[model samples]
Target: MRPGHDFIGVGVGAMVFDDDGRVFLARRGAAARNEAGLWEFPGGMVSFGETLAAAVVREFDEEYGMAVEVGALLGVSDHILPDEGQHWVSPSFAARWIGGTPAIREPGKCTAIGWFRVGALPEQLTQASRDTLTAYRKKGPA
Candidate 1:
C-alpha cells in the first residue's frame, strides 16, 4: 500500500547461475519504469494465474533470451519503491541456466547483461536484487 501504486503487486526474481558459478545480471535501461540504471537479476511481475516458478521462467526468457531451470526458493522481499509509487512482494529463486546466451532483448528495459561473481557484482544494484543476492550467498553454493 504505497502511494501511486494501486494493488499490492506480486513479482518473481531468479538468481540464474551458469555452470561456471557466475550469476546473470542486467542493467536496467534509462527507459525502465522503475529503478532505471540499476543492476538487477532479470525478473518481472507475476501475471494473474501464473505460478511463481512459471513467472521466473517466463521472465528469464523475456528479459535475457534464455531459459532457466527454477530451483529452490531463495527468499522473499518487500520491494517498495516509494519514489516510484510501487510496492511489490518479490519471491526470489535460485535457478540453473538451461540455454541461450544472455542478450539485451528489451533495449528499453535493459541496457546490458553480464555474468559476475558474488564478490564482483556491479556497485549500483536494485534493492530487491541486492537483497536476493545476499540471501542466495548466505545459503551458500548448491
Candidate 2:
C-alpha cells in the first residue's frame, strides 16, 4: 500500500470503557502522521493478515500501555485527512479495560490519556473518532 494519500490504511480503534461507563481517550501528539494534536482513541493501522479485534487489542496495549478485552465492533468509518493527504478505513470497537493503567507510551504520537464520560468528549476530535463515538452513543450505554 502507498500509506497516505490514495491508500486506505486499515486502522483499528479501541473504545475502552471502564466500569463507570467512561471511555478512554488519548491526545494525538503534534508529531503524529495526520490530524495531529487531536483527541482520538488509542489505535493504529492494522497490519496485514491481522484481524480487526486482534489489531485493536494490540494497538490499545501499544499506545496506552494496557491490555483490553476487545468486544463488539461498534462501527466503521473513513478517516480522510485531506489537508494531510491521508486516508484510512477505521474499525472502532467497544473494549473493556483488562489490565494496566492508560499511559502515553509513545510520546511522539500521543501526549496524554484519560477517561471521559460519553457525553463529555473533547470538542476537537478526529472525524473518524467522532463518528465512532456517535455510533457508540446511538447504541446507548450497556
Candidate 3:
C-alpha cells in the first residue's frame, strides 16, 4: 500500500442539461481554489450528511442561483492533481433545469455561467468535466 494514501476525499458534481441539449458550465474565478478561471459543471464537495443528489442540488443553488432537478447518474471519475496535492473521486449526475437562471452567486469562486451546445463547448473546460461531457455525448441519454 502507498504511504499517505490513507487520506482521500470524495466529491460530487453536476452536469445540468437543458431541453435543447445545451449543457450549463460556469467559469471559476482566478483567485479561487482549484481550477480557477477554468470552465466546469456546477458542483462541490459532498457534506457528511448529504446524499449525492442532495449535494448536487445544494451546490447548484449555492453556485448558480438555480434549482435543478437531478436525474439519472451519468458517471463517475477520479481526479488526482498531484502537482496541487489534491485527489478526489467525483460522482457526476445529470440534472434537468427546473428554475432560475445561472448567476455568479459565489463571486469568489465563480465568475460566470452559461449554456453551451454539446458539440461546441468552451475550450477551457476542466479535464474531468471534459471527460464527463464526452461520456455524456457518447451515451446520448437513456
What would the TM-scores of all predictions be? 0.93, 0.93, 0.89
Better of 1 and 3 by lDDT: 1
By TM-score, how accurate is candidate 2?
0.93
As a whole number from 0 to 100, the lDDT of residue 27 in candidate 1 is 92
Predicted candidate 1 versus true structure: per-residue lDDT over 96-129, tens digit per residue: 9989877888899888888999789999999899
Looking at model 3, which ten-residue stretch has the lowest summed lDDT?
A: 1-10
Q: What TM-score does candidate 1 reach?
A: 0.93
Tens-digit lDDT string for candidate 3 (17-56): 8888788998989754577889998788788778999999
Error of 2 at 40 (Å): 0.6
lDDT of 3: 0.80
Range of the 10 consecutive residues with the lowest summed lDDT in candidate 2: 1-10
Candidate 1 ranges beyond 4 A from true positions: 1-4
Sorted by lDDT, highest first, which candidate order results?
1, 2, 3
Q: lDDT of each structure? A: 0.87, 0.84, 0.80
Task: Report the backbone clash tally of model 2.
Answer: 0
**What are the C-alpha RMSDs, in order, of all predicted structures?**
2.1, 1.3, 3.3
Indicate the TM-score of model 3.
Answer: 0.89
Best by the lDDT measure: 1
